[model samples]
Target: MSSTLHAEQPGTSSRGTPDRWESQRSFDELGRPLRDITFTVVDLETTGGSAEGGSMITEIGAVKVRGGEVLGEFQTLVDPRQPIPPFIAVLTGISNAMVADAPPVESALPAFLEFAAGTVLVAHNAPFDIGFLKYFCEQQGRPWPTFEVLDTARLARRVITKDDAPNCKLSSLARAFGSTTTPNHRALSDARATVDVLHGLMERLGGLGVHTLEELQTFSGRVSTAQRRKRHLAEGLPHAPGVYLFRDHERRVLYVGTSKDLRTRVRTYFTASETRSRMGEMVGIADSVTGIECATPLEAEVRELRLIAEHKPRYNRRSRFPEKTTFIKLTREPWPRLSLVKRVLDDDADYLGPFSSRKVAEKCLAALHDTFPLRQCSDRFGKTPSRTPCVLAELGRCLAPCDGTVDHDTYAAVVRQLRDSLLHRPDRVVEQINARMEALAADERFEEAGVHRDRLAAFIRAASRTQRLSALTRCPEVVAARRGDDGRWAVHVVRHGRLAAAGVIPPGTDAHTYVASLRASAETVAGGPGPVPVATAEETEKILRWLESPGIRLVDVEGEWVCPVDGATRHLALHDAVARSRTELVPFDDRRDLTPVHQPAR
Candidate 1:
């Protein structure tokens, strides 16, 4: 990175004596006075972009400088636990193999933060790096530190003579300063060069008596001129879903973002109130804003994902959050055992989670066991059938499907009940629990009622996790497509009112085409609503075939749009719209005058 800017030794004023330089008439007209200040210049490589959606940082570097002199520096490689794009590897020369052996981000970020403490941040493009750092810190439950930021590129344009230079590049500045060192693209080198350039700008501006860090932090270019440019850029933006890139005068990317409405989102940062803080600082650095329009909201999400993945833009947060959070998997087997597993595992088992904690998963399982009474014993114990039932049977905790006392069909029915409970249909669980609790209470079985009450609480806890409930008579399915404003599309596969999977298709593709493809694939399944085959009565399979299929994405499922790919049933919302429209329609004969002759009766 520093190769772009040549490194210079400290205390070397290429210009005349400081006092004489300050007296220059040209410096007084064009520059602000410079002040001694400390700055922490930082940079990061990340897995992807959107902070909220999912992205992680892979590396970070920070250099501390005071009064144009280097104090210390910090740098580290982060293991993202995800595949690194080939281009990023080539550009940063930090390969997947390199990071693969490094400590994960959890261990590296805190160290970087400690080094960055107590200094104003300086970056070639500060917003991109700082935004990502802020977002990542927030996700880790760490407090984000606030600091003034100075953009070297912005300072260059303001202080450098346009007549003397054809272009304002870090390399050009390094060359002009007669510095021999070339900064490498790696974090440290770029940060170092940025530091050098900042020093040079300060030296030139010091002649104008604008000599303190505080003044630079609050510096704004010609008020009317800056406002006019901001307004012009805001006016040119279109109201569409798309990604926007903010760049400074030196053409370094400052920030990348996706918005449902580009014009509105971009314009917000230009308003008077927004311009006073970090965003204002960014605008001050930015010479132009560029946009890439997406055809639909989903396409915008996909593009944002791709860009973040590709560029590792500093401001995105999507990659920093945990991707393998744990959840409970209640197998669709005869025994229907519940087990804890990470959400990212590739196992041939039915799973549900990305839940916040294991306690929540356990509570849900316990409630389901109480309500459905499915066989919870291990298969080894179940097959060991003794003359008397196991402890579970004695405690009324199992229906004893093991001893042939409960038929296979009956056991399967119980399993279905357990599955429904796991799917968050608490009404049935509540009704059954209420009846059992009432029976025990009426019989003076106070202990049993109390146990049932505890189970009911757990049931309610699980139900409360879901935000919506579907009222479909049978399992619901939906095929929905989200088209981005740039014509890209995202196809979602929903099953039993849950988001099962999603796929991104190329831009300009029709939403209906992808939905139709999913529908065709789902139609081949045997027993379930999806394309997975179910076991026959003779096959006492340990797991349901359809439940183990890899095709399903398995997200929070609910509503009439369950299997959106099927699209056989229309949502009530759509029906209501049609109904309302029909009622408002007027016949042509009643509203129009057919005769050209004058209306004498009027």
Candidate 2:
């Protein structure tokens, strides 16, 4: 029988990574078949139940086999340098005298490991044997070699039943399968018996279509049959950074995601690792998984956001409603009231958001009102107004342009202050809010202070986000590079804060030539109307995050990329201060506090 997989010699690909051994063979692209997988069936007799309890291995035995044929055998007795308990000596028949003349573990373990190298480790209960080996390596200060392991007991529990075997014990299973060797508590005897039981279980699993090593490993888990049946969708996917879309029978996208390794990430959906409840349902109905390879992980992230926004897949909740984003629109009217709008138009009015929710936009609007007395009412009016005066006018909270109380020039001045606060001068508004909060705190009105604090935070956060995004969006073109782990530079071109093109330049390559080619092929973006470009807010936000990351070098820039000197980004510290205040423990209700004993309901 063949003892090794039908794999070709390893060779380097264009990317300087080893070519997949499975891809060059006539096997399932997902993984090698069970028959081609070699396994080392091992057994150990130790002095105690666990390695942590000071147990040490007394005897070790393993049989290296493939396709029901034994390729090699290993057995040794180790001088544990300690006394074996009476019960353990009786149970395993290995006594101190047996290992007194044997070699010590430091001398014996290396030989067994070399013999079992490059094969899957298997045992009746694998953790017991593997754990002891790992502990020995740790104690000896030797690094443990990574090995793929399988437990015969775990596999048996999935296929065998009480009716077939009275118990999952090695002796009971040997009898049930009519093994050629019966387990007798000795290491070699038990290991030989486990080999037969492993073959028996594999034969039973074969009927269930568990033909491949990957399937066998995942078979013991709670993977659904529907999920397993769709494993073929992961075939032929490049093991590169990319975006993947899971589509239904109608070719409609069901989900979209990004990963550094396409095949590994998509394959996890078919295994038990994908535990998200909705993902299982999505996989059940998914017909195919398609991959779009990217030059860098950042590009993959940008594509993922754009795809989710474009398709609005039912499985993707994030970035699905970029169109539904509400902005605090400073309307272009004689009485420019703050209006929460969903669409950003070319009307040349000032806008402050891309806020995810209307409630947040309203809070920001309230913050603006608290600072500048822009009209709150939505009524459009000419110079001569006909609407009734509201409470805000009586309280001097508004200029009350609706009753013709304030001229357009005066209201316009207040509007300019707000616009400057939104775009150019955020401190003009933040300082006043800070002063008001201090006054409220001085009056001991802590609850009202908290309310004002949160409102100011909302405005500062929105302003900061908008300013950061605008700084990138206003720039027509930006080229940046960051070195990757493989000594290559990942270069990307941004057009109006959207990832237009991306590529990688190998070490020692002419960066200028490569960047020129990237820029030439980049997507052309026309200047948009507002401070933000035509790109979706989420897309621009992702680009800005990548740009601000450490080690990102700006190779070239077209337009000026600068934030206002008094931009909201400068007030981020104050925003974070308010955010930190929320986590602090404070009195739940200042009005109703007991002094350990309710003092006369006062």
Candidate 3:
């Protein structure tokens, strides 16, 4: 992590001015040669996953290198202020005691920033490390210094082939190249390993004619020759936040994407940075790229969803199939049963979804059936006893409405409860399902309990999302504003959950006048059939995400925008915890060491 370059590179003199070699050596106009650029390779170990969620950096390690020689190193452990999660502590071997006496981020950040000043920053996964640094600076009210960033993993992806290494992970690349140090999860060790991987990748860059830093930045090892030939397609695109559409020879859209910088993002399609094989193929077939600039990132996002849904692009996988979403319907019959339907009709049937998939909708319906005595059979009853009771009735799983065991009025009451649980109130449903799960677990029915747990999670999440979206769409007019980092305000006019209009208000502009004008010019959107909005659920859901994000303020509202008190919001944490357990492959019953361990100050 520490070495000195005795010979101060061929281009510069001892006094730090350019020498004769600087003028004679050929270089690209975009930037300096890679050999002359100084890069500060950095790595950080944090208390947990996200900075915004109060996850703090536990250790910082960086190595400054230029011309393949390490210039200096900086490493320090920081007291996170909050206790570290036991899993994180075990991962990095940095227990609470290890950082008890160390400086906190308030003291440690400035030192690292100063140590790595005036140099390009490099990290294996640059976003995670850089995000923590940027967030810390914001919290401290310190101006983050502008520094060029290069991800070694991205660099490796551009240079190293699958034959050379399996993946771009630091350890993998370190082993691929005969590195002197091995990454051991500790910050300094990983940073040192990354420096070796960087050098090895730089060496391979020469064969690809990536001598200049600019060329190296855009180089991708797997980018085909055909992709490079279509680089001109990105020309004339504005470098602003918006949506971009890649069109085929017939002017049909092949793909749609949103980006903060339209030109840079579209340009990546022809470069190694665009790694998705499907995207590369799309770019190969693309005859042109069109950019639609928007006032804010929120608008860009909504526009992207709309464009993708409209075009149903072959290359885009997500929003293209939004119509395939299903809904859990309370059947409009004498003895109503839960049914899955594709569309929302005006038949007065209680609906709880627009679920992302049929499997999730089925899970939600299963939860309802497990809790209530709703008929499991699909047979329609004509008020009187028409058919024999099924086994579900004998097992006490159903009310046997078909055989007159349960009257229409009683069955209707149960249907009302189910609808209320799915829509306005979910507390009873949550309690009932949770109690069932506990009872099964008490009986040592772990597998059955696990199934119940998943169904409960799916039910709650779907209920929460549906209620949140429904509340927004129910509002006739809603106006909101979010202040950007640049001191401008992004104002949005939502009419029945559709983005009617979007604009930005400058710092000095009068907010009142600007908002009024935006509202006046906004689109006149009528309420759609039933509880839905004029916009699609996916589009409205995107608007809801922006409305709920931090810094968003409701400027005005024409109608009520509220979720029920006993709604799914209360159970959202349980849903999140269940999802996290499933993702981490942890047993649902194992709650130990998941919470932060507050070791007494050493």
Candidate 4:
């Protein structure tokens, strides 16, 4: 509450507080013109400080104006039906005698409301006046009509510096703006004074290019002419769920965004709400915005991921180079060791990932090595033994297949075990981890148990993702459809885990003709012959995502499109246990080399 009984915006702090005001009202910049706004500048003189403090308004005054011209005015003294306090009567010069002949508040309020109807409310410190009026309406059991409110105090703070105007009080602003009418606590005189203040703040806003009712409602001084010029880009977009592209002068895609309401979302770029520095830079270079309307948000999301993969737009920092996504593969060399590679080679090799990045692939690799005793050595080993065992062998992390310690047949069996663990039987992997965890816990070495628990969690996470992705990759083709806008069907054809074709089948058209046409016109995203790799991690991910979207009808599917009955994720109970143990700080962590939080028993 303020000294003048100013109520804060519903969930915000006062003017002197360090929180930005939260406001929401619908006003389109292009659709609703600001010049047509019927502004009712209002003021009130009350007997007490606060509405809730049993205060009653003595006088209500307002001026309705538009385009710098006064349309109408309202002023009235109300018989509070209660005695006015001595200080308030003295301050407002509205004594009991002055209002003796005045009508009671019950009758006067209706006339005031009629005069102020269909007008946007304006007040220097709005909450105080509005609060009093609202309380009166509530007391009379009359529902208060809602009005779009503009606080000159907030507008002044955004426009004027503290050095120019020490504060945003109506009298202070009126005097600063060189108004002839001085506020001396009389309601009509003060309301008239505030009208000048309102116009003065609007003048400041106009200089800042906030000409629309929408722009002024969300006023900011940073709106540049260049940014505002781009508002036209959003003007033609439909208010539907879809993906939007921001393209530059070269017709190169600079940024891509998805929105349920394309028009509103794209228009926000020019407003003050878009506080991201990179977004401003994106908007500065952005010449046009194009929208691709989708039937569902899931389709929009999938489309966004695919576009990000294909274009690799400069402003899109993530998934741009889906080709850069790495994979962990067991090579077909004589040694048959694991290696992280970018492209999935044509050579027959056991592959695990399509991991999001090199770091994640490396992390998964490190986690896998902690449990599996496969050959960690990178060198090719013929039918004979190569170099002696290395440090990893000494640490018992590797099977030492490079030495006679592990024979060729034995190493081959171990390689098969690792392969089975990755592709088909992660159940064995989960069992081995649980056994190790149980041993650690039985010895009362809980911290080590925690370490084991965390490693199990990481291994399961990587394994689960890799398994899911590999399943999709192995599918020869998948055709799916979702209901599109205007009663159409949005169809996607996936070949070898990449978008083969995409198009819409209109409501009245024969579906087969459009599908064939779409496939004919379809640009090859993947499965094209070239030196450069065509398919991407994101492309496969997009197909998987769309398949997983709710209400997706599977048109057709090829290959074994099913999860293994005994797949790695089957031991979901183990995953749950590991998750809980880690949370209890059975103390699972990745920082194994860091300082010991507790000294475990030897």
Candidate 5:
């Protein structure tokens, strides 16, 4: 993008002298306007490109200007709490090491706001930088200032003939404006260059109805005729699941969302009386709306989440849910057992889960012990020299670690077995059930076989309920499901032990893709070793890689575990050819009947 000005000539002005501002004649020589106005030229070095969602600014620099002269400046480094990508480090030279000790955004935003008070904000790409500022301010519950924004880039495009310019980058603009060589990508230097470019643009556009700060702010805030046209355009959207975007006249994004009924949701914003209250003010200020429609609600939700995480929309609120949800951690001690707790501790223990609630955690632990029978007593139970093997041992619930009969290895083995059961690989349980039922039937023990069959049914029910958060899928899939504002529900399908499909489900759609996505996912996970517990950062990364793989197809489906394409069979073939390969099929919940079926050759 070009700067708003063209260079006249380079001449040293006494403008930089500390005491020059005190002379009234100096102000006149500088052609200072009589109007009372303020502008702050700002720049930021961020974690990386795409300021859409979670990407953060690591450094900010601002220089305040009035009339046509520079006044003062502000600059600071911010901690983004995420690793700066390698490409960013190479370009900006703001290394991860340099920012390791920097203060977080919460500590620096107030100071930046204080410096920017009562000023029209100006930047090279004003929308990109200011959009993040607005988002940050809103998250902190601080009122967002309605400052008039000026983009030197946009202004340059208006004045400089596209073919005549060497390049529209800030560096090119600086050189064209006769600015001395300044450090590139450094926030302060870039801010200074932007100021110089703006001054030049104003001089060139002088007599052509060039807008003043007040005029620009009014234009930026008014609901323009063009915006009405765009809203009308949005009215023609289909009433199907998808993601939608709202943009200003300059095409800067204002909001992002997903809905099962796209037209209905978008229309609601235009019709709601409260639209004037929450987002209406911003929407009214917008000049146009853009959207991308998906085939399913799940697809819409997935796309919405990805966009929100990527673009960090000023008005979008769903991206913050991951940090707010709670999970349960199981300690990995020698006789390591399970406990319902919040937050993962650094103690020597393997984390079992991140459940939605304490009640869910308790239920999971109870069901697990009932099926697998690991020790539930504390370490202190056997150390006190108990007179009899604890009640749990007498009831055949535990091996009685308290009796000193079960060896440490044997006890640890049982614990591992329990862990495997909770992880949802019930092959051992299945084998045990099959063996007992067969022995009883062989002896004509029908009643015993029936009891074993019931036990096996209970085990299947328990196993099905096991929640698989990041299970790999069989195809490249996207499922879109809406939870509460803070809750996220996703189904990942793993085929041949690899992620095949994944997605978020937007609200509404109750059949088709939702069921197909689940069945495909289950087939993928069952086709492999099933879903394994992700415990460490490396494991988490592995799961993420699988989910993000290009080969994985994300689909939106409804009702748990139903086939997405053919609904005739509730059972998904876990051993299907696509699933039998290295790809594994994993499902969110066993809400659908996924029993394996054998077909006779045609």
Candidate 6:
């Protein structure tokens, strides 16, 4: 996989980074009550361009609303105690004569603060108004109130297209929306017009499934104009856990994703936080958004994996081709040797891992050679041919299997030892390396020890994950359950390491009927193939994680899962205790506390 900054590596494109990753980011609850939120929409007329440019507030107007009802209003003329520029007077019509007898800004600030306390602040261009008010409040020896601010300009960019209004200016939007209250540049009239625009935008957003304050505030600035127009694609999607498909005009699937709230997740594509240019391009061509409502989040996730594999959509970057994943296999040559291969077959050879990335595989391979006496040669032998011992043999790192110095029987014994260390007893390798690291550090060979230390960490991460995946894949059948966002239980059935059946079991549903129906439906899918190959390694890892989630109950299972006990993974806790205090980091006594903890039962 190429490591391009903009393009994701293959088998990883389907997943998002921490910021936008579906599983990483928290979701809004099933039904977020948007109407109950109170908002204080404020506007200000200033004497000049900006607060930083010696401008002061000339007028203040705000309207507080909740559930579409006007809670209260605050309006006043503020004396800047300075001359109002002619350009400002012409633009806002708030001239020196109008504010000559008005109360000073000190007097108007308090009343507006009282009206806006404990509510969201919104404005056409929020920074200017908020900047003016916040500066004066501080100048008056009062603590500036912290208020969540929303910009109507940003929201307008998301909701109203340039075609609808050439620009999102207040006058343009007012004329376009046909607001009865026209903005004549006065503060109160403009604020009233903004209120109308706010209501109009909210009405449009409601149809697009955007109903929360957070959603409205960030929708416009981040999403492109083309994406905003396609909000109608999500008009009919249900607000539940499910999968969504973004399709082109030719009915080609461009992207696929799963979310607990399909409507909200799909709407997020056209919001401000979604700043990926590639996603913007995808949205430009997407003609429709389609969704499939699943009974549970687990079911939705499983469906996403299958769909990504089947479609191989252009926009999707991850899990596109599991077939390309590499495995570190011990080749069944005249002399058994470790080698990286793309596919795992029925060849009589032992396999250590089907690693996710090649970088890690190479690190583990290099570390393994350091600990075990294995031949590093590329010669394929039909019969034992006469050859000289290489440099690795001279350094005592190899047994010289290519030469007559190490006989076949003796080399075979060494290969068996290496196999034992890799498969069942990985601690033999970790403990050996740890001892060497400790020795080097004692002799002030710090740089060399650090290399071994990093190699230890790499081996542990790779081995732990490999062991967990192998444990799940070895089982014939397993059933688990986790509570859904709603008051229901989501049951997942796995057979031969693939998701066979998954459906919701409501609190009061009949247990026997649910199981029967689930099994009948699962039979159609589970019977497709016997067992997944190394190509489906990602599925095995995903299943392992799902099985480890909290509150998961084991409804049924088959076979005992054999776990590796004496590995760097299980020994990591011991290493961690001493790993702190790098200045005096001494390897503590080897301790193994990696006990198996079962998921919670219902």
Instruction: Using lDDT, give the best candidate's number.
Output: 3
Model 5, runs deviating above 4 Å: 1-35, 50-53, 81-83, 181-183, 214-602
Residue 372, candidate 2: how far off, in angstroms?
Answer: 0.9
- All models: lDDT? 0.55, 0.80, 0.81, 0.71, 0.57, 0.72
Report how far off residue 3 is in candidate 5 (Å): 47
Candidate 3 lDDT for residue 280: 69
In model 2, state the lDDT of residue 66. Answer: 97
lDDT string for model 6 (1-602, tens) is 77745656544435535444444345743334558878888888776545765668889988898888889888999999998643345445566778999999888999899989998888887876788888888788999888988777666765565457776777777787887789876778888888888888788777665678776654433455777888788878999899999999999999999999999999877765565556777889999989999977777887887888999889887877766666667777778788887766777676666666787688788778888777778778643757888999899998887777778888888788777766666777787887876677557566677677666656666666666666666676777877765767778877766777888886788976887678668733332211245327667667777888888888778766667777436654433322321111111111111122344587
- Any idea what lDDT model 4 has? 0.71
Better candidate number, 4 or 5, judged by lDDT: 4
| Candidate 5: residue 170 lDDT (0-100) | 74
Best by TM-score: 3
Candidate 1: worst 10 consecutive residues by lDDT? Answer: 535-544
RMSD of 5: 24.9
Could you list the CA RMSD of all candidates, in the order they appear?
25.3, 22.0, 12.4, 23.4, 24.9, 24.0
lDDT of 5 by residue, 1-602 (tens): 77555444344244343454446555544442323567899988876443554678889888898877779989888888998743344446577777888888887888988899877788886766787788788888999987767777765654554333465567767777876546467789889888888777666554443345533321211233433444574676787678988777787777887887788777655542221233655666666667788744544655676576567767665462433323434556555666665555545454444544455455545545655656677665433334467688889988776666677787777877765654546666656655766666557565666555444444343343223333322223334322423343455543332333545555575546675746555423333111232222222334544445554444543233321231111111221211221111111111111122344578
Q: What's the count of clashing pairs in each model shown?
A: 52, 0, 2, 0, 76, 5
Query: Which pairs in model 3 have colliding backbones?
Result: 158-221, 220-272
- Rank by lDDT, highest first: 3, 2, 6, 4, 5, 1
Q: How big is the positional error of residue 168 in model 5, measured in Å on the Cα after superposition?
A: 3.1
lDDT of 4 by residue, 39-105 (tens): 9999888776567866677899999999988898899998877887433443456778888888888
Model 2 lDDT, full chain set: 0.80
Which ten residues in a row are the worst by lDDT in model 6? 583-592
